[model samples]
Target: KIFEGNGAIAVKLFPSNVNVTTTLALASGKIPWVEIYADPLLNRNVHEIEVESEASKICIKVENLPHPDNPKTSYLAGLSVIQLLKQLSGGTNIVVGT
Candidate 1:
């Protein structure tokens, strides 16, 4: 969805050395309202989580760790969903086997 909306994909320090301030590096004023960007100084891999809403001019960013084995995959991709469902099912940390 993001790629389709932006019509461009900016990738850096991906599957390689992650250093310095990384970003989407999109064209000037490319994004209509808000654009998602990520540059983790410590995390070698990351996912630039961003949301856009023209109706309210809302842009949300939520970065997450990449797959333990592969930096390309998002760690929260599946774990987050599982965690949310667990929490909704009366699950708790340490006590309920979160």
Candidate 2:
């Protein structure tokens, strides 16, 4: 079955999939308009975000391969979390992007 809706509905129906939206809302201080789609045919997890303002417009899209041992989560996502932990622990002084 395929599911589609706004962020609130996505949260209710698919809590595990709303991490990006939650992070965006926290970082931007605004709840973003969101569209969620559940497609069984897709072999990879895909996320797309677009933001526009008076000064600039930003668009980002990421397609992540599923982890070999854990099909429910992406391999890249796991690596990202590890990297974040490392950064938070002061393992690196370099910071990229805002």
Candidate 3:
């Protein structure tokens, strides 16, 4: 059951070193979930994700990589600025997912 199940996932978790909390939260990764923290060498540009469904909760982390086009910024940097401006300008939320 460990190697084969109806549900399977592959995640590359870095050196949060590890976590006891997620072990309990996702127990056996059965309900479909995992957690991780970034350990990208000495990088500090942190990124986080939180996912939850009726069955389980998962959290992930990564040290954000800077956009090659802009070392001081991540790709989302442009999108974020646009989003904020949209918000301030009263733009609407375009529905993305169901």
Candidate 4:
């Protein structure tokens, strides 16, 4: 079954980074309505997700910190890219996680 209605949510965050929305799109397999905010008082990036489906209603919140070595990127995002590259290079016999 798939969600079959128009849904809306407001995504607010610092304009400097919006990768979380991209990540969420990938996870949910759909592009979501997004709104960005540049908050000077925030020391960390924040994301909130809300989903309403026939079977369930789900909400998620995440706070992210910049990579220690690279301030422009999230540490986990960088690692995920590297992990994908490793998988594509066929260096390992076992692949883990979706």
Candidate 5:
């Protein structure tokens, strides 16, 4: 996909695998160039992100394990949602780093 300017473009290519890119774009206000690779030989899903600017560069890599009950959902993904819900409900009353 050729992007003329800046925007998230993963929806058309990989709709089911776009949480990371979408969250990053919304939080950072910078559209990230996204690339998805399918590896049947691997047991987990992998995401690698690299951001470069004139003064700084950031690299992030995440390997998410598949949920035992549901292969379509990642274990970490569900856990994160639960954590977010707990935080929003004020059940923990603890400040956690995002």
Candidate 6:
């Protein structure tokens, strides 16, 4: 089954699940249109994002595996946090992406 609603409402209801939307909003300085789906057929967490601007149009889709120790969390999310920490700590001078 799939459920659709406002991302703001979703943030309040499913804080952890919809956190990416919140991060997107903060990064873009705009509240993005969000669609939440509950599909039992999917084994991994999938996120799709579309952005259009006068300069360019962007589309991204990512499917992340669940953490081995925690099914509720995406493994990539934890890795991303670790990477951020390493960057912040000045461990590396090479920054790949913005």
Could you give candidate 4's per-residue lDDT for residues 15-89 as a string of tens digits?
A: 345556666677898877664555778766676778889999999987778789986677777788888888888
lDDT digits (tens) for residues 23-58 of candidate 2? 888898877677777788999989999999999999
Per-model TM values vs. the true structure: 0.32, 0.74, 0.31, 0.61, 0.77, 0.77
lDDT per residue for candidate 3 within 1-98, as digits (tens), equals: 12221122322233132233344337655443433333446443563546677999988775655667776566566677778878877886655399
Q: How accurate locally, in lDDT, is each candidate?
A: 0.43, 0.82, 0.50, 0.65, 0.76, 0.83
Off by over 4 Å in 2: 1-6, 85-98
lDDT, candidate 6, 1-98, per-residue tens: 24466667778777888888898989988776778888888989999988898999999998999999888899998899889889797996665699
Model 4 TM-score, all chains together: 0.61
CA shift at 87, candidate 4, in angstroms? Answer: 1.0
Lowest summed lDDT across 10 adjacent residues in model 6 is found at 1-10
Error of 4 at 24 (Å): 4.3
lDDT, model 6: 0.83
Clashes of each: 0, 0, 0, 0, 0, 0
Summarize candidate 1's per-residue lDDT along 1-98 as a digit string, tens digits.
22222223222212232211133323334433223345546473433434445655543445566778766656765586678878787776434355
Residue 61, candidate 5: how far off, in angstroms?
A: 1.1
Best-matching candidate per lDDT: 6
Error of 5 at 83 (Å): 1.0
Each model's Cα RMSD: 10.4, 6.8, 13.0, 8.9, 6.3, 6.4
Candidate 5, residue 58: lDDT: 89
Q: List runs of model 6 lying over 4 Å from the truth.
A: 1-3, 88-98
Q: What's the distance in Å from true for residue 60, model 2?
A: 1.1
How far out, in Å, is residue 50 in model 2?
Answer: 0.8
lDDT minimum window of 10 residues, candidate 4: 1-10
